[model samples]
Target: MKELLILVVVTIFTLATYYLVEPFAHSQMHKHVESEHFAYNDLPKLTATGDATRGAELVMGGAGCTGCHSIDVAGMPAPMDAVTAAASYGVNPPDLSNAGAVYDAKFLAELIKNPAHALLVEHKFDMDKGQMHPMVAFYGTGGDLDQEVADMVAYLQSIAVKPEELTPAIAYETVCGRCHANHYAKWTQIGTTPTFKYEKESLAFQIQVLEYQDSLVKYMGTLPPDLSIYIRSRGEHYIETFMENPQNYLKGTAMPRVGVNKHAAEQVIEYLKDSGDAKRHEREEVGKYVMIFMVIFAIFAILWKKQVWRDLH
Candidate 1:
C-alpha cells in the first residue's frame, strides 16, 4: 500500500511537470509568444532579430513608412515622407514592439502572413475586419509558400521587442490584426495597396474632431483625415459612432469595421486620449519637400540607367 501511494505521487508530479514545462518549451520552439497574462502560439517560428534596421530603411528611402503613423509627433507635420499625415479611417499606428513576446515566433509569423484568418483562429484580438499590408504576396492562391514565407517570417521575427510593455496576442488579435491581415496580404501580392500610409508623418488635423480632414483639396486626394485630437476636439459621440460604423460614415473607405464594442471602444478612446500621437506631425513639411526631390531624383536615375545600359550594349 505504501509503494502504491509513492507511485501515485510520482505520477502526479510528472503530470504537473508536463503541464508547466510543456508551455515554456513550446514557447522556446517558435510557436508561442509569451505575455504577462496569456500566451499565443499558432504560426510557425520567428527569427531572433526582427530586422528593425531594415524596417527603418523601409521607413526612409521612398519606402514611405512614415506616411501614416505618429510616434512622438508634434507641430503641423511629422518627420518622414510619402505625403501629409492623415488619419482618415480613425486608425492609429498600433505599436509593433514586443508583438512576438505575446506568443511565439510561429504566432507572429502567421499574424504577419495572414492576419485576418490568423487573428480569428488564434482568438487573440477580436477585430471585426482584417489587415491590408504587404506581408505575404500569395496567400490565397492555394499553393505552397516555403522559402518566401520563411524570409517574410524572418523579417517579422527580426523585430526587437520590449518585454515589459508586452500585449497579449489575444488582445492584439481581437483588437488589431483581424481587420487587415487578409486585405494587406492580398494587396501585397498584387501590389494594389496605397503608396504611402496615413500615420504620423502625413498631414494631421490640428483639431481632434472625428470629422474628415479634407480642408485642402490639392494634397487631400491621397491623404487620410487626422485623428490626433479626436477625443479632445470632437467628443466621445463622434469617436464612438465612427468606430461602430466607419464605412457607413466614410463612404467607400479603405478602413475596416473592427467591431469595437461600446466598452472596448471606450477603452481605446481613453487610451488614445491619454497617449499622445507623438511629435510625428513636425516632420511633414520637411518630408513632403524631400519626397518631391526624391521623385525628381528617381526620374533622373531611371533615365541615367537607360543611358548606361545603352552605352554598355
Candidate 2:
C-alpha cells in the first residue's frame, strides 16, 4: 500500500509539472530577459562596412578624442609623430586599431556613456568588462557625455591595429594619463609629497563630507555611511582593521575584502590619514550641497516669481 501511494504521488507531480511548466518553457516569456545573447560577442560582428569616411573629422574635432586614442584616419598621420608630440606634455595616446573587432558600435557608445558598466568586471559584474575601464571613471552612476563616446567609438572602429602594436609606454599613457595628467604622472618628475593642513574647518563641511562618503560607499555596494567622521569616533586602528578585511569586521557584509593579504590596507590608512583633504571632501560634499541648494533655490524662485508662493498665503 505504501509503495502504491508513493507511485501515485510521483505520477501526479510529474503530470502536473509537465502540464503547467511545458507550455511556458517553449516561450520562456515569464522571465523578463532583455537580451541573453550578445551579438557583438566577437569582433567580426562589430566591424563596420559603411563609410568611416567622415569618422575622421569627428575624431579630431572638439570631442577631445585624440585625448585617449591613436587614430590612423585619412587626414591624420600614422602615430609616432602625433604620439611623441603628446609625450612632451606627459601624455600617451591609446591604440585605436582592432577596437571595432573588440566591441560593437553599441557597446562602444554605452562604454563612453557610462563607464561603470564598461569597466573591468572584478569591481562588480564580472561578465561585463566589455569595453569599460577598471580604474578610469566616466559617465554612469550619474555620469554622462554620451555623444562624445559615440564619436570616439566611430574613430576607434575605423582603425585595425594589432595587440602587439600597443607598447607598455603607450598603454600607461592612454589609461593612467586620463586622471593623473599633472603630478605622479610624469615619469621624469618626482618629489616629496606635501602634507596638506586643513584639520580645522566648518562642522557643516565635515558633516557634508561624511554624507558624501556614504554616497560613494553606497555606489560600491559595500558598507553604507562613510568613514570620514570615524577618525575621532572609531579611531585609526578601527579604520585599519576594517580596511584590512571589511568582511571580517562586519559579518555577511557586502564589502568584498580588497587588500587584506597584502599591506595595501595599511598603505591606504597612511594615505588617508595624512591627506588633509580627507577632513574636507571638496567635490564630494561641498559640491553636492551646492548642487542641491541651487536646485531648491531655483524651484523656490520660480514659484515666487510666478506668484505661486503668494497664492499659497
Candidate 3:
C-alpha cells in the first residue's frame, strides 16, 4: 500500500511539473519555428495545371530565368557561373537541376511572386531601396500570370532528379552541396547518390534546406570544404566535432556553426563514409572467411603430414 501510494505521488508530480512548465518551454521554441506566418500544412495550393514545354519557353524567353539562374538542360546556357553570379547579385542562384524534384509547385509559385513571403521572418525591406532583393516579383507581363507560373512550375517538375524523396545526398546538397560543388560533382561522376533511411522526404523540405544554405554562404565570405571524402580524410569524430562547432577545429574559419543535431550529422557522415568506402564492409566480410579458411587449411595440412610421417617418427 505504501509503495502504491509512492508510485501515485510520483506520477502526480511528473504531470504537475509538465503542466506548470509547458507554456514556458513552448515559448522558448518560438525562434526555432523559422517562419511565423507559414507552415508545411498551411502552404497554399496551386490550382492551375502546369505545362512543362510552356514553362521552358517562359524560362528562356519571357521569364528571364537565365538572367541569374541556370539549368543544364540540353541547349540552355547559364548567364554566369556561381562565383560570377554571386559577384553580380550578392547571392548565387541555385541551378534548377533538381528544382522540380526539390520544390513544391504552389510554394514555387508563391516564391516567384514574393520571395520573403514564403520565409519564416519578414525581410528588412529598408536595407536597400531597389537593389537588395535578389529576386523581384516576376509575374510575367507578356503572358497570363497564372498560366506562366503554371508553365514554370510544370517545367521544374518535369526535370526532377532521381531519388526524388529527401535523402542523405539531398541533405548534403542543402547543407553542404553549394560550397563543395567539386566534391558533389565527383560523387555524381562516381554514381554516388544520397540515401534516406531515417528522415522523411519532400521537395518542399529540400527547398527550405537550399534556402538555408544560400543564406549561410551570403553571410560568410568563403565557401565551405567539400565533404565527399570528408569521412576518409578527417574521420567521423573530426567531422562531428567540426560540424558541431567549426571554430574548435580551425580558428577564425568562415564556416558557421550549422547547428546540425547528432542524428542529422550521423546521417550525413554515414552517407559520406558509404559513398567514399562502399566496398569496405564487403571486403571486411570476405576477409573474415578467407582468414578462417586459411587457418583451417594450415591445421589440416599439419595433421595430414603428422599422420603420414608417424611411422618415420
Model 1 lDDT per residue over 2-87, tens place: 99999999999999899778866755763222221112222354444344444444333223433543322222243322122223
Give the residue spans of candidate 3 off by over 4 A. 1-39, 126-131, 164-167, 174-176, 179-313
Candidate number that wins on lDDT, 2 or 3: 3
What are the per-residue Cα lDDT tens digits for candidate 2 across 149-268?
544566565574434443433332332222222222222111122343665444444543334334433444542432333445555565555544444356555443221211223333
Evaluated at residue 263, the lDDT of candidate 2 is 27
Candidate 2, backbone clash total: 5
Ranked candidates, highest TM-score first? 3, 1, 2
TM-score for model 3? 0.49
After superposing candidate 2, which stretches have Cα over 4 Å from the reference? 1-51, 72-93, 120-152, 161-313
User: Worst lDDT window (10 residues) for model 3?
Assistant: 30-39
My TM-score estimates for the predictions, one after another, are 0.28, 0.26, 0.49
Cα error, candidate 2, residue 125 (Å)? 13
